[model samples]
Target: MGFFDRNIFIDIIEWLPENDDLIVYKYDRHDNEIKNGAQLIVRESQVAVIIEQGQFADVFYPGTHTLSTENIPLLSDLRGWKHGFDSPFVTEVYYINTKFITDLGWGTPNEIMLRDADFGIVRISAYGSYHVKVNDPVTFLKEVSGVEDAFTTEMLDEKLMPFVLSNFTDTLGEAKVPALDLAMKYKEIGDECEVLLQTKFDQFGIEIANFIVENISLPESVQEAIDQRASMGAIGNMNTYQQYQMGNAMGNVGEGNSEGGSVNSTINDAMQMGMNMGMASNMINQMMGMQRNAQAPQNQQAPPPVPSGPGAPPPVPGAAPSQLSFHISSNGSQYGPYTLDQLKQYVAEGRVNKDTMVWREGMPAWAPMGTHTETASLFGGMATPPPPPPPM
Candidate 1:
């Protein structure tokens, strides 16, 4: 009775948040009886909710309020008391900041398992930050309000982090973003994540202002495998690689002999062999630059004329010869210059569609698969009638 006597009048009931937080419950003498003439102060971007006997009574927004029977009808009804009573009342008031709370971190506690285009099934880890806000304080109070002196963002994060990652798994899988190309699709993934999380957040009276993916990474072993595959693809044909290495070795030896003022017949023979093979213009020039001035007369035959007739660019010396490969345009992306065999595989895999645009060497321009007579053969058995029995 002595402690309650001094708290009858609450002149100030305000919450000054230390940081922009999700929700903070305001304290008014810690559930003590608030006199009828007491003051309730709420600031902008904040909402004050009153709870009487474990039920929400009234809500105040962005203004000063006086505690009185007129505005306490809901409270009076919940408390089963008549209006204009002379006695003071007991209630709980919580202030929830509606402003955006940013820089909250979220991440997958466990590696995300996804199928990649190049690496097949691989595990990856991702981390990001997001901004959130409270949209409905009443619903938040009913669902997640903790009976503490103050409810900080940490508590919200404990509940939200799991929700975010769960939604991330579904959204990322549905987007089908390749792990090798995940970096390029951050914005796309983030946008989709926001949409995917909106419905769930709405249920808790929360709004996700922005969701961002800062980094996505794969396991070291998986990354190494991908790198090796890419290196092989870049090296192309093995025979061409051997020729290129031979030319490079000769070039280095020629430089060494000229520096020592000695003749290397073996080196000269290898250089001549590379030149006779119609090495690329660039490689021929590089090898010739290493030759000594006195040795120029020994190999005086003019360089072979570069073959150029616009059939297809001559196979680069020491490089895979350019082959007739088709470029596929699908889903707003140019897939590749796939060889005939690879194109057959793609068709067999059902990756090509009637509207798929394809172009190959000697074609003036790209045309739909169904429109090109030559490439149309790639899409065989696509609703075409079977040939009549021969001479039946």
Candidate 2:
């Protein structure tokens, strides 16, 4: 009631803000004074700061404290108090929440230029959320909270957004994750960002409790390109895809539901078109360094069934077909019915050799070209007869 009355000053001070996101709260001490022996209550995940005039004087952790002239000599000296000559001192009491404030959002406010391997030069943006708390209240108040009585996560988000985006961009760029692989590397990038950002945020007295990367978005054109690539990947082997398309078309033709087979014929034509396209695509891919496995020809007629067992007669060479033309199996593939001359050309081209399997229409079964009479001439007759007797 009276300035000189010691009992009239504020007795105890504590804070419990109503707003959950409130990071800093200044206790209202309207017309009240911080005199000697005042009680200060600081709860868990909370910190109290005593700022005298414009300069910080003291900070209190989670505990009950009794303010005394001896304990707070700085406040007493700053107030110029000597004995009981001076009255209560004017000070600022701030409460900082040390609990993790969740759902604090961050994102790239603008598109960042990126040189992506798959898409070349492209622009990308990213978004994520994080949690934070005041790890160092004194520094936060002096450097960040900055004389503001009430501070909230929204205010903190505005300050940290640019830094978050900067770190995210650098981390993502350094990670060198391809646009096609960004979906798989979200966590990796986020983890790196969290590590890099902690170093920066530590000096500001804020701690990133957890960092997350929800999505790294690409440009619309780049996204469409990715989708197209994914679709192509889904198709797997182009040859197999073409076969599948043809199979579907043939299955439709077998249904016989179309009038005069018009639809069936169209389906067949489309399938053929797809096969041609697939062949061209394979060639282009090969030229572009996308090597594919060489597929065996599926349409080559199988060599006539071999007559097995030792009892089967080894047919006399003279009884073979008169045409001298034969089919040959080379490197696991069946080739044309070539004449002796054509076989010689094949030998010249290195497509046929001594061990090549050859079959003429009249042969009992396919026989090695070197051992078969009709084809043996291609590899130099089995073993030439010795001419030494004439010299002797």
Candidate 3:
């Protein structure tokens, strides 16, 4: 078309599959008519090449583009047509920037914190050219700030840091100690923090993945006291010095009596002394009895006299008898041949004397032959004969 033509038709041509093309529609401000077979030229924005043809053909590279027209039938309706570039859909990501961790008295930032501390403090920078694309552009424009600007790290620190610190401090304070000990408690505490941060971040559509406690400080004095008490308590019992001394003393006493001494000899002496005293008492009693018998009344004779016979001696007078004989019935049998000296021995032995029974040859029954002679009197119906005068 000529520059001043009014009846010139400018068609906006678009190619299939690759729309990166441009066709400029130039119109005449003053009224003018174009002749048949008028030639026109077209050019694109990116390339500097020019085209000459009867009908303008818009050729494009292998990409998307926009086309416009001034006077063609369907093309004129696309006068203000612009290219529609579909951007990646970006969901609103709410995170806390923990670059101010030192100022907030928290630990380092890590993936665990990023995933787990969704509503809690997190230190991060824009990653992988991540830009916000609004699904609800109207809501994005109206509700969210910085729509014109990118979501920067500084924005996170300025807007979210205070809320993160406040929430984190409150969470840490309210965090319960695990039911288990250190090794197990660390995992449990991390899990609990993750759950807590996830719940807090639910309003912003964030999910927590992990959490951690970097450092724990306990008082040195408390730890030392605990160690000392444990050490002392481990000693359950102790030995005493006095017990050792007592054991040593007992050992000496046991060792000193290795051989027996004069104890046996002393016991033998005491037994012999007792025997001698007993014998002397018996002899004195016998002598006293002989003297009393010698002085008895004639009508109360002490005993029958022994008649002198072959190889036998008559009784002695006023002298202790040399021999005495008696019999006793025991166990349904007659059982004695005791002599006067034998009687004295028996009396010393605490066996027999006044209680002895005698059976003379002419007597019908046994009689107690003694100074008190009731047996003789009961048997013979006569007084006991006086002892034959002691042998001279």
Candidate 3 lDDT by residue in tens digits, 13-36: 221212211111123312232222
On TM-score, the stronger of 2 and 3 is 2
Best by TM-score: 2
Please, what are the lDDT tens digits per residue for candidate 2 over residues 248-292? Answer: 443332123333345435445655666676776675564334555
Show where candidate 3 strays beyond 4 Å: 1-105, 108-145, 153-183, 233-392
| Candidate lDDT (C-alpha), each | 0.68, 0.72, 0.33
Quote each prediction's TM-score.
0.61, 0.67, 0.25
Residue 299 alpha-carbon offset, candidate 3, angstroms: 85
- Cα displacement (Å) at residue 360, model 1: 35
- Comparing candidate 1 with candidate 2, which one achieves the higher TM-score? 2
RMSD of 1: 21.2
Model 1 spans > 4 angstroms off: 1-8, 28-32, 225-241, 251-392
lDDT of 1: 0.68
Q: List the residue pairs that clash in candidate 2.
A: none
Q: What's the ranking of the predictions by TM-score, best on top?
A: 2, 1, 3
Candidate number of the best lDDT: 2
